[model samples]
Structures are given as structure tokens and as C-alpha cells.
Target chain A: MFSQAKHSSGSGKTREIKEWVRKFASVPEDFAILVTELKCTEPGCPPLETIVALLGSENRKYQQKVHLSIEQIGEIDAKKISEQLQRQLENKEESVERHNEH
Target chain B: MSTSNNKVPVTVLTGFLGSGKTTLLNRILTENHGKRIAVIENEFGEIGIDNALVVSAEEEIFEMNNGCICCTVRGDLIRILGNLMKRRDKFDYILVETTGLADPAPVAQTFFVDDEIQDALELDGIVTLVDTKHVLMHLDSSSECKEQVAFADVILLNKTDLVSEAEIDQLEIRIRSMNAMAKIYRTKDAAIDMESILNIKGFDLEHALAVKPTFLQPDYPFEWAGVFEIDNSHLKITLSEGPDPSMSVSLLNIGEASAEDVTALLDQAVKTFSDKNISLSPGGSIDSTGKLYKLELAQTGSKTFYVKPKKAGKYVLFTQHKPEEFSMTIERNEIEIDAIFSTNYEASHTHDSEVSSVGITSPGDLDEKKFNEWLSKLLREQGTDIFRMKGVLSLAGKSERFVFQGVHMLFDGRPDKPWADEERSNQIVFIGRNLNRKMLVEGFQSCLKKNRQLSIR
Candidate 1:
């Protein structure tokens, strides 16, 4: 099971970890293995073991989340998922700009 | 050197476009026996050859982590070879299918350049497919085609079912003129004896050299000329081997007009080849397809050209260019040279074969002066046929293995550390045409304490 988690207080280390994940995810089938390797190298990234456990946990929210497919997980159709992520990031940038103006 | 008690041979399958290379590749993969095979298909596209169609099980080593492995040409070929070596335990033999318009030289060069690839996989043989119907045309207009034939250890003249006897004969003659060494087979629908394709090792240098006509012979110097006109592209023409070097230079100077004219000539040749339904290659892009004409200039002013065709048969220039215009002097001794070129002026020596090892021993009983004389004569005579030599030889009772190598006229010597297996016998591999094996055997043997025979069978 794969999921995308958004977190604030992102440092250079966190951004670097994300970029590594993106690069690893570019390859087919080996994405999960590469992601797991990256998590070990990542300074403060979430442990892949924790993610796998969470996906199997007995909580209603976790169970419902398990039902959702990882559209962003390097399936060739991830292009659509990337477009949605792009829109969200753009909106967040606009709001930050407005907050700084105020 | 293919398999040392279990090492599988890696065979490279190469040819021009639509030459039935892939068809032969599929037959080998699907029909072969118990050997666990790995297929490396270098295409202009990303997709691999169809698994169900080419091989039943693509599971062993299909996933190459390198982005360039499955696509492009030599760059991808090296990566694929590297990846295959890493996973060598999975397969018994590796078969690489080069792109239709690919040249075998670069791919063959990969085995020698990368030490890791070289150690893991020995270049077993280069199997080139020539489409019978279009081979002549391809040879006439495609430079890549000429290089392919020149580098082949074995040539599969496939699709012979489609052509007439006369056409095939003309094609064989052209192929031989370009590559005197390659074993040509007239196949029907790409069908070939898989065993014959796989087991082929180094070339029979003596055989190749013998087949090459002597352009150095006196009294054959004659002038001949033909104007090749083209509208759009370059004309790929080949001079048969044994061209007297002086005449070749003069002919090249005449043919060497402006780059635009060369392109126009090629375009017209390709147009004609297409009109005749002969194939022209580096096939896809107009810009990518460049024809290289192979010419042999014997020292006697006699010349021959080898044209790799796209559709028509190969062309040979039998006489000199007796110009209707002004004249140029043709000198003799200047004919002994080998040169290759493109419009960008990157013509250097196109052939890259080298004798990577040598063995030498000076007998205790033989007189030093007499031995030196015999060895010197042998070196000179054998040297004429030697392209690149690099190997170590045992010197009689000495513990050291003498290292020696030469490329064309250049030779060098050094001392190498003694091998653990002294019983392995001192051996040397020579890579060139017309090398006299019996003469070399006798010369080296005469210096031996018990007459050691050096036959590279």
C-alpha cells in the first residue's frame, strides 16, 4: 500500500529526500524498493515500515485510506495525479503570498 | 575463450534495415535447446522485442535499471552488456540484436573497451544479415552497410528465396569485395543452422588474405571513369580491395567535390535504389543515413571499390578515372595505405582488430645470430598481415612472459609477469587478413627447443 503524506516545516533534508523518492519512483516495479532505500538515507523522512504497518492497521481512517489506490505511485497514469498535486501547490503558494501581503 | 568450463558465448546479431535480422534472432531464441538465454535488443524505440514472439520467458533479465539500455545504439548496447554481466548467473548465453541500420564495429568495440564487459562476455561472433533482394542496393549506397560487412565474422544472406541466381551472384561478389573473410550463406526466410551461427570464433586470416586479389601486381594499371550524378543525397560507392593506392587518391580527389554535391549524388543514388526497390540504410532518417564506400589501393596502381548497396548489388571500379578534363600524375609506392572518411573528415583506420597476446621463446641450442635472422624475417612477413598484436610470450628458460604487440607497421615489446599455468602453452592471436599461418608456425617453431607450433585454429 502506498500513500502521499504532506507535511509542513520542510527542511532542505526533507526536500532532498522527496527528490530522491521522485527519482526512484521513475523506474518501473522497483519503485517501492528504491523508496524504502531512500527512507533509510533520508534524515527525517517517515519510515517505510511505519507506512506499511499503518496501511494494515485496524483504524477506520487507515482502513478507508487502504481502499484508495496510490495514483501517484508511478503508474503510467500518474500524470493526472501530478496535475492535481500541481494545482494544490500553486493554490498554497498564492495563499502564502496573500498572507505575506496582509 | 568463449566458455571456460561453463562460460556462455555472447553472439552479436547485426545487419541493415529489413535484412531479416530480427527474424533470425527470434528463430534462435525460440527454437534453441536447454541453454538459458538472455536477449539484448537495441532499437531506436523503447519497447523490447515481443516476448511471446521472440522468447517464451523474458523473466530472467528483462528489466535493465539504466534508461539507455533498451534504446539507442552503442551507448545502450554497453549498458545492456553491463547489466547482463551483473546478472550473469541467470543466463547461459547472451544474444544481442542490434538495430537494423546499426554498424557492428561500435558494438564489437564495446567488448574490448569496458573491462568488466570484456571479462564477463567474450565477443563470440558478429552475425550480419544481408537481405538478398536489396543487399546490392544497400551496399551501393550505405556506408553503414559497408562497415557491417567489413566487420562480420559470418554473414547471413537471408531472403534469398526472393531473388534470381544472377542477382544473388552479383550480391555475393560485392559482399566478398567488401569483406573477403566473412562466410556467406544464402538462406531462405532467415532460416539458418543455429549451431553454425553460434560456434563461429575468430576469422581464418590465411583464407581471407588469399581470397583478396593482389592489386600490387604490375601491368594492371588502367584508367577508367564514370560520372555519378545525384539530385539530393550522397552516393555510397565502394572500391574493391587491392586498389592501387595512388589511383585511389586521385579518384577520391575527383569524387571529393563540395559537400552539397556529395549529398546530391547520394540522394540520387538512394532515389535510384528506391526506384529499383533496393534498400538504403541507416535507413530511417535522411540525415542519419550516410554511405561509406570501401576502396582498396594496391601498390601497383590497380584499384577496386566495394559499394554496400541498399537494394541493388555491390559495385566494383575495375579501372582508373581517365578524365576528359585536365590530368594528374599517379605515383606508385604511395598506394600502400588504409584510410576511411566521412564528410566531416573523420576518416581514420576503420578496422579495430588487434592481436592482444603474443608468445616468444629463444631456444638454448639454436645459434643466437641465426635465430635472430629467422625471427626478423618471420616478424616482417607476418607483420604485413598483422593489424594489432598484444600478448605475452615465454622466453625459453626465463620466468618472465615477454609482452609484444603491433598495429599495422608499428610494433612494441616489454616483459610481463610469469603466468601460474606455464603448461597452458604460449599462444598469440592475430587479427588481420592474409596472415600466413603455416609460415608463422614454421618460423616460431624453428626457434623452439622442440619446435612449438603456433596455429590459431
Candidate 2:
């Protein structure tokens, strides 16, 4: 049973994902990026999820999650996540600028 | 308006453990001053026993527990102070006694930063009591002790009976050296005159100006400070080895003089550096009358500023901003020469971990829009680390003086009384952790009116 049990272990993949996210997100050097592999207990929630959170000024957080384990995430998934985060950041900047204008 | 809108003076009493702070509090409460006072005791332990000792006194006593007043209990203080304001009719004065290890900056800043607190109460003064017998050991071991001494407007040397007269004199000298503006009083068992401690108006700019002409000058921390000789020839000043990326560099020429007399002139110039009366030139231009000039780079993070003196004479370079590591050298004829001078005034000693106070006094009207934008962004980013900020400013196109101050992110400012017959100037002090004095000074200089001619040379 122990030999058959499946575990999420992908240090190399995780490192690659983080590097790709950092390069595409263009987050400030001071801003921190936190990646976590969380398991959901709720019946309707995804069984396993990978959350990538970018924390920056004014306690702002940008999070993108994939409903899959770290081991399952590949370059294509990382690219998609980075694009989503970049769009979110651009939207945030636009909203902030508009707010300042008003 | 809230009933607390009426300005009730709040006095912060800070001291080390076994420093007779309680005795002084008790005396203030029991003394027949004919004024009702409220006491807020910030106790350290789980149990609140100090209030029990003061239960017999007629003054209203409020206890704040959980942690030191300077840190975790600051919110508790704000809440209690707000509550006390509701019962303002019962008391005419508010006294806050901080725990032994508390830094008084936050406590004093509470009044300035909070809108409700600012309207309800005025910071009368920070009165720090020092135990004559054991304060030296505490001062050497604890940074809190030094900060308490530094932030004090009035320091009472209590327990004088325990120490000899010679020791008391030595202690007073040391305290004065750290904070020259504070009024020092000798007492035994915290027995001080009620008039000396209460309603002192130490924070009142108008009253303080009346007492000491240069009351707004801030004490800075730096390893070395000196005056250097710079002739009409082009000189390349390189700060390649300083700890910080930049340093506050002021160049002032008090006419033709020898290198031997430069130290004495520099001493006089340092006094004028923080003097609120003397006007400063805009954009670091040479002041024609005072003969003082501040050097600043056009861009940030650039350490070198090529100096071509207008006239051949002696110029003083005073470097006392934050840079704990490395040294400075001046390049003459492509040769790196160690900048040499005479006077070596050792600033107040503190570890790199401690918060330091940096004061900048300029004698030019500030552009209001630029100043507000810069200050707001600064507070938003680093307000938590910056414990206290106070400034009396002279804004362009405004006859009234602008007096503003803050604690953490909360800042308050308003047009104070008219300039009257006094000279218009700006004096600002920032007490915080890891403060970049050079950046702050440069940023403030950038806020001056664009037309350099407006500045009085």
C-alpha cells in the first residue's frame, strides 16, 4: 500500500514554474512571491490546488491557482498562470490610475 | 463635535524600572494643584496592581495591560484615551505613565497621528525620570533607556539621595550631551515642584520658540563630522566607501581663512545648520549673507558631486548623516586624499538596531503641493517604522505657519497662527528606524519653490 501511494514531489518543476512566473509577472524586487500546495477538505472544492500569490505594496495580493498538484503543472500551465497574473496586474494599475485621476 | 474636542493637555511620564516614576505620578495626583487630572498607567505584568495603589487618589486612574505602551499597547492607549475624552468634564489634564522599557516616541506620537486624539488632547511634554544610582548600567545595556532620555522635554534626575553630588553632576552632563534642549531638574524621591512638570508646553511651537530660540533643532547620529578646505579649483568629492548609498553633505564658505581656523568656523556653521532663524538658499545655492550652501545631487543614489568653488577661500564640509561603515575621501588632481580636519564631536552612541532622530531645518518657503505628495507617499510606505515626525513649515503664498506632525501613518497638519514678526523658516524632525537622512534631506530640498531668486541668500 505504501509503495502504491502517490505523493506530490517536484522541486525541479516548482523551481521552473517560479522562475517563469517571476520573469513574466515583472513583479518588483521587494514584492514577495509565495507558492503553496493546499489540499481541500470541502466536498465541492478541488482535491489539490497550487496557489501562487504575489504580495506587494498596500497589502495588495494577486493570486492564481491551478486545480492540480505541483507535479502535474508543466511549462504550458506556468505560462498560462503568468499571463493571467500579468493581465490582473495591468488591470490593477489602470484602476489605480483612474482612481487617482478622479 | 465630540466633547473631547476641547484641547486637554496630556503629559507622558516615562522612566526605567525602579526609577521612582510611580512616586512622581502619585505626587502629581495627590498634590493640591486645584486641577482635575486623569492618569493612565501602562503596566507590564498580567495583573494590574498600580491602579490599586492609586485608588485612594481623587484623580481618575485607567490601567492598560498586555504589553509595553510603546508597542502592543498603543492601540489600548488610543481606545482608553478616547474613552477618557467622553468623561472630559471630570478631568482637566491627562497623564500617561509608560512602562519602564517603553520608547516614548510612539506614546507622544499618538496625539499627533490620531485625528480624534489630536482634537481632544495636546502633547504637553514628555517628562522622563532617571534613577540616579542605576541609570548608567541601564543606559549602557538598554537602547530604550537612551531613547527615553533622547525624547524627553523634561528629565527629572530622581533618587538623588542615593547618589553623591559629584555623580549627579556627571549624570546631568551626560544627559545634556545626549539631549541639550531638555530641562534637567534634580530631585530626591521624585519630589519635584508641580509647576515644573505640568502644563509645560514643551510641544507648543510658539511657547518653545519663546523659551529657546532654536528649540526645533533635531539631534543626529553619525560617526564623524568635520570641516574641509576647498579652493576655487575643481574638486572631485567621492563617497565611495560610506555605509549608506548617500550622505547629507553641506558646504559653507565663511570667507577666506586658514585650515587652522576652519574647525572653529565649522562649529559656528553647525549651530547655524539647525538654526531656524537663518534663511537657506534654494537648490543648495550659496547663501550670500550667511555664506552657507548645501550640496545635493540632481539624481538619487549618486554619491559624487563635482565642486567648483566660485571664490578661492576656505569651505567647510559637515558630514553627520547615517553611514556607520567606511570613510570619505576627496580627489585632488586625480589623487585620492583622506579628508582631514580637527574637531571630532562623538554623537550620541547607539547600536545599528536602535531608531535615530534626523532633523532638517531650512529657511525657505516650501511648495505645498510637492511637499504634501512626497510626505504622503513616504508615510504610506514606511510609516510603521517611522515612529514620530514633527515639522513647523513656512509654505509659499501663505502668511500663516503650517505646523504638522505624525505617528506611524497617521498625520495631521493645519495652518497655525500667522508668522507675526518672526522669520519664516522650516524645521522638521523625523524619529524612526533605519531612516535615510540623505534621501529625506534631498527630497525636502526638491520641494522648494522653483524660482531660486525667491530664497533669501
Candidate 3:
């Protein structure tokens, strides 16, 4: 693992986070996972955040964010964020099923 | 690769069913008004044209593995354009009439994806026809309707005679808000000057929308700015409940300042809005110490707030919502004081629009290094959300205006015609989804050589 002091913006941290997202989300290695750093100056928006977009096998796009900057994120942070995204994905699946049943 | 001269221009006609696509197609085909046109239409039976020029379009869409997320291209369009190339002298132009329900992206993507098609054919522009009378119903319900309008380079709001002028104006605002860069031509029965619509070179890196002052007043960061010359004594700004439950106001002191000073203050107020606003109870005091103040209204009846200037000769009060909405009045020493200088600013951001246009036409040369950094960062993160952006910019130290346009993140720009006798100014229009005009203006302002970058920290 690269130095945590080496901001998450570095390629090493991005790759590690991508792996954690795939592992937590239960996706294959070839799955599309993108890590982006966004700085939104607008109020209520964190000064710096990490946006992750993961494409599911079924093609449903899942997007989530860690409030901290990439370098600031740890393995625990990534795991928690990924699990939250996974839960979101499951909730959406349940909602879609509910709609189809009706 | 064939030069632009030989490239057969293809214009995509898209709209909901019965929005006068056939009318416009037949008019262009039969008018004998000049250039030989070959049409690739899926709905062949809709038009009565029984000629060599009319070819049936095969609706075959293939998912592209080119890594451009979900990029789908029409297989039939590639085959058709290839066949048309063999019979070189048959036609100079290609018009593809897309089905009302079809997503226009695939058809557009074909030109960009296919190497041979890109060489021989130019994706001229997409023209969407809007059924003005019934569009509001579809606009609220249909994603297809929204996509068609959002993807257009030009729009024709057809059947205008059926709707009132006020209704047309609202529809125009709705459509214009969706695609700011697209030139909207109001029409009845799809009646349009064929010369004006055809061969416009709209998608060409060089060709762009004429920099007319845009009709995007509602999307301004703030709705109103009332300038007043007040003393250190307490002054009252009373408002009888207006539009929204809450209102945001930024009172900035501009003491004995010039027009340029007020302009700088206006930029300051735009950034002030994004800072944590001090939510005040109805009768809370408003300090003119440069900060955003939000006042809660309605339940407490008429909201009367006091403005205690730090030491004010002249102060500009920027309201998120219009002062006119809340019959607002300012009084000093129980005597009303008329604004020595007053101007209304539109600083309200767009609400209820997934796709909106932001037009910035400001005078001044922009610092090149600053502009490059701001724009590169903007396009890098926001390219997927941004559909099309085009502009003519006045770059610092450049005599000529820089002309540029981009699809998604692919931007192309160059030094164009010099600003000879005319005044040097920058005018740009962005047609995209969830575009923040305040951010765009602030970013652009920060790049300018004249004004200090006061909008962003």
C-alpha cells in the first residue's frame, strides 16, 4: 500500500479504492469502476470529495461519494462507502421489483 | 479523409409524432429549390415521395464497445451512408428522419463512431420540431421528449397558431432553458426558410450561434439588486410577503463608487450567496458588512428588516428573489429615500430544469492561463453532464477573438477574426444539464484580467 500521506489523488490510492469498491460491491475485475475527485464550491457541498461510479453487470450505474478527499480516505472509509452503495443498489432492486409486481 | 467540402451533411429531424416533420421534409424535397437531397427515413410511407432520392432507413442499433459509456450507434445509418457514397453524384446532402420515439443519440453517435462515415459525412445538425400545444404534457411525462429537445442544435416550435402568445413565450422559455446553444425558430406548419435551415455548418468547430444577448434572465444568480445611498443611521427594508417563503439578500456597501465599482460589487454578491447564510427571523437586523442574509417570511406577516450600514454612502442590496415580488420599501428617518442609482440583476439559478442554457456576454479580455485552468477543470469533471458548449472569447493579450465549440469534452478553439473597430467582448452559450450559471460566470470572471477574482475564494 502507498503512504497515506501521499494524498488519495495519487494513482496508487485510486487503484486500491477501486479494488475495495469492487470487492464490497461483489463485481468482477473487468467491471468499470471510476474514481473522481470533485471540488464543488457551492454551499452545503464539501470542499473536496471523491465520487465513484461503478457499472453493474446488468448495466445499472451506481454512484456514491466519500465526503473526505481521496488522500484523506482510509480502507475503513472505502469499505463503509462501498457497503452504503451496495445497500443503495439493493434498495433500488427491491423498489424496481415492487413496481413490477404492481 | 475527405475535406469538409465533399462531406455529405446529414441533418437529423427529431420530434414527437405529428410535429410537422413530414411537412418540412416534403417541402425541402419537392421545392426544386436547389441542391439534390437524399433522404433516409424509417417512416417511408409517411411521405408520398416516390423517387430515387428517398431511401428506406433500417432501424438497427448496435452497442459500441468504444468505452464511451453506453455509446450506441445506428448500424443501418453506416450502411446507408456507405451506399450513398458509391452513387456520388446522386445527392449533395442527407436528411435522416428519426422516429418520434427513437433516442437521437445513437443516430448522432454513428457519425462520430464510424471511421469511414466520419471521413465522408458530416453530422450537420439535429433539428427538433415541438408540438407547442401538447408539448407541456409530454415534457412533464416523457424522457424521450426531453432528450430530443436537449440534443437539438436547432429547434422549431411548430403549430404556434394553436397556442396563445403568452403560452408560446412560456414554451419558448422552457425549450430555450433546455438548449441554450440551439437557435430556436418559431414556426407555423413547419414553415421555414429552407436556405436558413439547410447547410448551416452548425456542428463545424468554427460555426457557432450568433452572440445575441440570451433570453436566460430567470437563471441569474440573484433576481434583483436595488442600489441605495443611505447613512450610518438605521434604515428599514419592509416587504409584504411575495413569491417564496424565504428570501436571500446580500447588502454590500459601495461608497461613492463608479459603474465599474458597482459591477465588481455585483460579482462579490454572487459568491456571497454560496457562503453559509445567516438565517434571520422576520425583524432581524441586516448588517451591510458583506454577507448573505436569509429572511424567513409569510407566517410572521409582512417581513420588516433593518439595514444598519457599517458606514455607508452608497449600498447595493442583492436579493435572491425580485423585490417587486414582495412590495419592498426602504425608509430612513420615517421618510422614503429614492435610489440615487438602481439596477435590477438576475442572479437566480435555474430550478425545475434538468437541461438549461447559460449565456455569458461580458466585455474584457480573459487571462489565458486562468481561463485554460478553469475550463480544463470544468470540462474534465462535468463533461458527461454537459452536452454542447460554444463561445467566442476575448483572451488576454490577443487582438483576435478566440472562437470555440465542443461536444462533451472534445473542445476545439483558435484565434479567429480580429476585433477591429468593434468593441472587444466575450459571448458564450452552454446547452447542458444542471449547468450552474453562477459558477460559470464566476469562473469566467475569475479568468478576466480586469476584475479581481472576488467570486471564488
- Model 3 lDDT tens row, A1-102: 001011122256666777787777765443355555444443453444455655433344555655576567677777777776677677654111100010
Give the Cα-based TM-score of candidate 3 against the true structure: 0.64
- TM-score-wise, the better of 2 and 3 is 3
B1-457 in candidate 3: lDDT tens per residue?
2235678888899998888888889888887666778888874437777773877775666442212223355656665676677787878888899888877777876665333455568888889999999988888888778878888877999999999998888788778768766778999989998866777677665576553425554544787666777776778988887778888888888765456667667657767988898988877998756788888885746778999876757788878877778888889988877666666765433333677777777777888888877776676568667777778888878888788766554454667788888777887777677888679887888888896433221
Q: Please provide, for model 2 over B56-131, each residue's C-alpha lDDT reduced to its tens digit, 9 standing for 90 to 100.
A: 1111111111111111114445546656766767878887888888877657655543233455578888899999
Candidate that scores best on lDDT: 3
The clash count for each model shown is 59, 0, 9
> In angstroms, how far off is A24's CA in candidate 3?
48
CAPRI quality of model 1: incorrect
Candidate 1, fnat value? Answer: 0.00
Q: For every model in order, what is the iRMS?
A: 24.4, 24.5, 14.0
Model 2 CA deviation exceeding 4 Å by range: A1-102, B1-6, B42-89, B103-119, B161-181, B203-355, B420-423, B450-457
In terms of lDDT, the poorest run of 10 residues in model 1 chain B is B62-71
Give each model's whole-structure lDDT: 0.42, 0.60, 0.70
* lDDT (10s digit) by residue, model 1, range B300-376: 33232222223322122222333221132222233321122223221212222221112232322333344445644
